[model samples]
Target: ASQQFKENLTLVATHEKKLELKRSACPKPGPGQALVHVRATGVCGSDVHFWQHAGLGPWKITDCTALGHESGGEVVAVGEGVTNVSVGDRVAIEPGVPCGKATCNFCLTGQYNLCPTVDFYSVPPKDGTLTRYHVHPAGWLHKVPKSMKWAEIALLEPLSVCLSATLRAELKLGQPVLITGAGPIGVVQLLCAKASGCSPIVITDLSSERLDFAKKLVPSVNTYQVDTKKDAKTAAREIVDVFTNAADMGVQVMPEVTMECTGVESSIHTAAYATQSAGLVFIVGVGKDFIQVPFMELSVRQITVSHLFRYSNTWPRAIRLVAGGVIDLLPIVTKTFPLEQADEAVRHSADRTKFSVKTLIVDGEE
Candidate 1:
């Protein structure tokens, strides 16, 4: 009976085209795993990228792949040897399942985000949880507070990313921070920064609509709308001017901590340029295989450049932050759609004009 009623939406590819939402039977949890009846799954930017671009960077989607990672739901059943949680526990799923072998440097260091054997959900060749029911490792499920909504719980994944970035930069209270790209992750970083007591948070983006949304989410964040279509040099010059002027007024400009959330080369360069001498620059965005860094300037200024992969050891902190009312998630959820309308939801997420910050695929109504 469990196998008979299980249904899932899969991404299938054809000779000439690709199709998403082709349904199939649900899966059972293997050993040390749990089957979750998905209540809410957020449509992430990476999900949209998979739906449209068919892959992310080097990972290719050659076969049917489910498309969701940001999700929260109730545990329905657990496999043998599981004791951390049980049926009916509300949870926020951490999407990455890393190999915990002690031999691996990443695992040994507790930086499992960089584990070589990491299998991330919603990534190509790996089925994700954009369905009625899904299975995940028991250890990756983080219990959520009773007062938190499924929508807010779904944000834990993105929040983890921001937390990792902040942690990497050693973000401190009352420190000025500059974030590039006010997209979903960028805006979430702004929220996390504010909640962590970082002051004078500033964000820049190409879309006025997105910048407006960012303002709505965190009014205290100073925002700038730049024309991305302009030449990279011109754009960088304008940003430099803005930073210099802000610095002149004794306002914290050229932030001590810079979170580069946009993968665009120009934005990365701008972020590097905008950082203060000897400041920390945390690169959170995934870009091309090779990027041209301003080595001369970087060396001259002695800036600290750090990179981020998927988050590690951050789910619990993210959940607590949202549960404790330190970060408000309601403003970031710009739209919602039923599970059956997942296709439309993905399309809306890809369209910036729709003001889509984070779209939710609702599997429950009540």
Candidate 2:
């Protein structure tokens, strides 16, 4: 209620590979919005990429803005018409809010993530929640139980992506699934597939440590490391062989679905080759803009390959999965840093050491 209370500290991405801590005016919640006192924010790969590359794909940072999207905090204030949340409620920020207009086909069809006018957090010119306070559409904020920690609540953002990918794959119980890459997304997909009753899920990566970490999370999950020196064609064949031979012993039974969480070209090829005919392949990772693949081969196999952007309408389910103990993300969070050390936090996240899985920037003790 005082002028001093209206100032917020923000971690701004000032330039390429640089972040500066500065004071910013706390934003006020407008109608249908809620002002959140951000408690913790996760350093995502995209956040690190934006800092290192200054942009992603065609989106470039046009201005100096805060740089975190996966965050959670308490609702401190609300605007008129906000009914779902109240002051003092803990919530996870969804980060993406579509242009609320009925004329848009994507929004009208319930696929708001595809809305061209959507403004996602930390995507170029947009300032993210890497601040002590933030304002967001109340509809995009999902409440969490008081017992949940802020870091865990913030992680729902990545989990939402995994859920979207799992949904797109049309995953079924007892179906075999293949996932490429042992990065955070791939690991999350592994957990989601396991919860969906997918049996004998296989994951591949370049790091044996990451693969071992995946196995630690789920002992039943099968992991393999890709040989970097091998030719792509040969590597793909070998990767596919593991999937086909997983359950039937030496019998060669293909997985019904493949979730390609690695943007690597070879991994994509392996995903296509490993899936059974009439199966689905979901490109879940963000990678190079263009890469050559065995399209004609996949065409003959009648496998469908699809790509998903950010999630839509998935926060509630993600929260349910974590709250119900169907998924545990705490193990994935390996490091934590305070707001003052935000720059170092992102840099650490960029490094894929044997122990680095997920990193968090906390506002305080949480």
Candidate 3:
């Protein structure tokens, strides 16, 4: 069972905006590393963004980089000092690893997501796990339950994100919350909020179709379709009404917490405007370089605006949530393609008309 790989087909994204399968030498695990037989990699919007733009923020593609971050695999080999995972262990890969330096304040304090030297997978310059085989830190490989499907395991990455955000929000039982955006993250956030016992959760999105999917995921969620033609204030007032109408919603004036997952300018404005005074708005989505915020209103209302940078110490809980049957992620995986068609997978993910919540590229049908 410890057979080494001679070579593997790697899906590569070039600076010139080309995707092709390149013959790559299988990488061997070094000390504290594990060689993973990648079973499946889920496509994120960022993956599609990088494949189309060849860069994101400060990270630009100077050479070909494999594009995929959400992946789960089986360990094929373990290097020296590797003990967390063994040969043939089914595991989910936590794609980001920060420089484990005591001198760094963020890493030392366990907020490694903010570590300046963090290496994030599929974020340009760093090769990701879209290939059949990948080498990852042993400590980052979380052993998932055998009952979890390979593609479903890949979903742990996104689920961890929502879980981490919800934890940061410090959700109180029966508290009303607002989740802006019905994309993959928003729906998962709904699940996390529900698990935390959040009541009368309200979600807003521009597309009725995406909101419909979220409604199906959580029928109790108050789905609000945003009219883009309306200004942020107008939409915000309507959202407030959804929660303040005591006759309709429970004893809540406005949502105590607002988790903005869209990263759009107006949606963010709506979140700020709609959240109750002294409430918290957790920014889960990455927005533009410069977004106009209502500084005066936020300052006056005493609303705390916090931005989430990936996750920290959430992989194990994420694994447990699914393995323990607290959540089921199979529904989020709407379409799957074989490894050879990774380009199509990314393309499929980018196409709004396709409207698939999550698309996966697997080593093969599994």
Candidate 4:
């Protein structure tokens, strides 16, 4: 059915640090776009980050815009030139769409994620898919296996980030890897690392409860609780000590790869220190504009550092892993809310005491 002139319920970020559900006009599909019946939308850290501060990094909410990007649903209608997917197809929304112009260097080279002109959902000017009906680029919609649940499809965006981190780190099989932060990203990284055959993986976080929960989520993962009071160097030394003794040869050693999922400056420093010489440090977290790095130590050790921006061509692999049961995505979701409670859902996502690892807003059931 045509969404034109149809009234729908949408969650909007109106005013300073406020989220409210409002009635809005449903969007109709234009050329190369499809109208989707948004079934599930996962609230992300960025969404909370935006709502808490009413902005993120360089982007601020100037106008009333919906807040949600990690989403998937059924295509109810397709516009002209849209043939990849059809009505009634269950699909995962990629969220970020670059200017697919021929002159755009980033898009032409298949590095669309790097395109400066990209319009990402829920990031300032672009309205997100928090409503019952939304129109999105047809190419950005990926059909999921029918067996995949709505929640899993919605979470594909974050899973893509985890896959990008794993790929950028160039994780080697059987190599010891260190991960900092047990938040959703860190937990997902743990899964990706294990799936890549990384052995003796170590994860750290400030919350002992989160660390314990990480172990419960992935029984094989070795978790450590970081002492926030201690300096990064001392914490790094202590973490390395555990690895030194756990080495196969019982010789002093450090992890070959370190994925810093926490944006804390201390965690970044600790990751650099815990990684062995000639190893790799993957900075998967976003932080301040500039961070102090131990350049001398990194240079002396010849450690390679890399960072990932969203993801590049990772959805297929992420989908297969989840659909094939190679990775269990459901465990990451700790709470679910209806669309009407989006404001509460965002608040719960930011409050650690609420025990919400991930919060989802189902389109209906309010």
Write out the backbone clash pairs for model 4. Answer: none
The whole-model C-alpha lDDT of candidate 2 against the native structure comes to 0.85
Cα lDDT of all candidates, in order? 0.80, 0.85, 0.88, 0.87
RMSD of 3: 1.7
Which of 2 and 4 is ahead in lDDT? 4
Question: Tens digits of per-residue lDDT for model 2 on 202-297?
Answer: 888888889998999989988778988877668667766776666767777677898999888878887787788998888987777789888987
- The residue ranges of model 4 lying beyond 4 angstroms of the native Cα positions read 1-7, 364-366
lDDT of 3: 0.88
The top-ranked prediction according to lDDT is 3
Structural similarity to truth (TM-score) of each candidate: 0.91, 0.94, 0.96, 0.96
The alpha-carbon lDDT assigned to residue 195 of candidate 3 equals 88
Give the lowest summed-lDDT range of ten residues in model 1.
10-19
Worst ten in a row by lDDT for model 3: 243-252
Candidate 3 per-residue lDDT over residues 1-366, each given as its tens digit: 558476788887889877878887888889999989999998998887777888778878888899899999899899999877899899999999999898999999999889998999787667999998899989988998888899878999999899899899998788989999988999999899988998778899989988989888888888889999999899999988877663264654788899999999999999999998999989998978999999988999999999898899999899999999898888888898998888888888999777788898898557
Lowest lDDT 10-residue stretch of candidate 4: 1-10
Residue-by-residue lDDT tens digits, candidate 1, 107-178: 889999899989998775667877778889999998887899988888888888888888878888978788
- Residue 336 in candidate 2 has what lDDT? 90
